[model samples]
Target: MASLSVGVACVLLVLCMVVPSLAAVYTVGDTSGWTTGIDYSTWTEGKTFKVGDTLVFKYPTFHTVDEVSSSDYSTCTVGNAIRSDNSGSTTVTLKAAGTHYFICGVVGHCGNGMKLAVKVESSSSTTATTTTTNPDFSYSSSNRSSFAAYFITWVALIVILVINVSLWQEF
Candidate 1:
């Protein structure tokens, strides 16, 4: 019935409103990626990192991504690394709120400024995320479909409500 369709549309509208937006994906070092000679500090400056955001490190086979402690990061020591990835294309998710340190495991790479230190927040503010666009980084293209679906669902809900109201008046 028309009433059933309206009810389903209303439910979809609520779901669209309640569901949190997808987390953002940031390309580390931008076009430079995780490599030597690049100023990782400058790249991360002024950028707000939050839990659930992803860091994609694209590099060559000779380099490696090593997650280390703050002390190890300062000393460029790979002996005590917490995690090491040599896949060249590494994706790391920010799972917790705190300072995270990453360095290149290859000798002298970290010393040459191939290291990064990011302070991630627990969660981003939900109030200002209706459109979910980050000024610092480009959003994922896949998220566009989600936003489009949300908009269509919202409009359908409004139309359904209007039709239901008019039908009520006729009875």
Candidate 2:
């Protein structure tokens, strides 16, 4: 019984340490999905994106997710796109800490408000703050904890509580 308890504790400790480092997967535009006429700027509001995070763009075949330079994104141009995807679903992994711009490549779609600019921070960053920019609005928010971090904190607290309870019962 003691050996089993120790094994469980060891496994939980490893999971607690590993889970917080796991990346967050965000579905862009949420339930509405990636589409024109949606407020992409507001969608990014109050969200802090860290490196290693994943952004999944789900949209119809009619739309294309085109990654472009800051200048191209501002102008809604796609001929110089850094990356382009027209499939029904597109998954983008944030590899570094910087602002990434994406827009619909279809004519007038981007102009109709199908553009998103997400600012990513290094995972090691202490402060959580992100700024999402668009042609019409620029938003910056701070101090939000990642889901993984929060989940691990709760798990650790529960484990501590259980261990203390077990010890008290023994007394």
- Local error of candidate 1 at residue 44 (angstroms): 1.1
Q: Which candidate has the highest TM-score of all?
A: 2
lDDT of 2 by residue, 1-171 (tens): 495499568868888688777878788999999997799999999998887777888889999888888888898886787778888788777777778899999989989999999888878946534543221111222112366568778877877777787878888
lDDT of 2 at 25: 74
Model 2 residue 101 CA deviation in Å: 0.5
Roughly what TM-score does model 2 have, to 2 decimal places? 0.73
How many collisions per candidate?
Answer: 0, 0
- For model 1, where is the 10-residue window of minimal lDDT? 130-139
Report lDDT per candidate: 0.75, 0.77
Candidate 2 pairs with clashing backbones: none
Candidate 1 deviant stretches above 4 angstroms:
1-20, 124-171
- Tens digit per residue, CA lDDT, model 1, 19-70: 5455666789999888888999889888888877778888898998888888
Cα miss at 129, model 1 (Å)?
A: 22
Which residue pairs clash within candidate 1? none
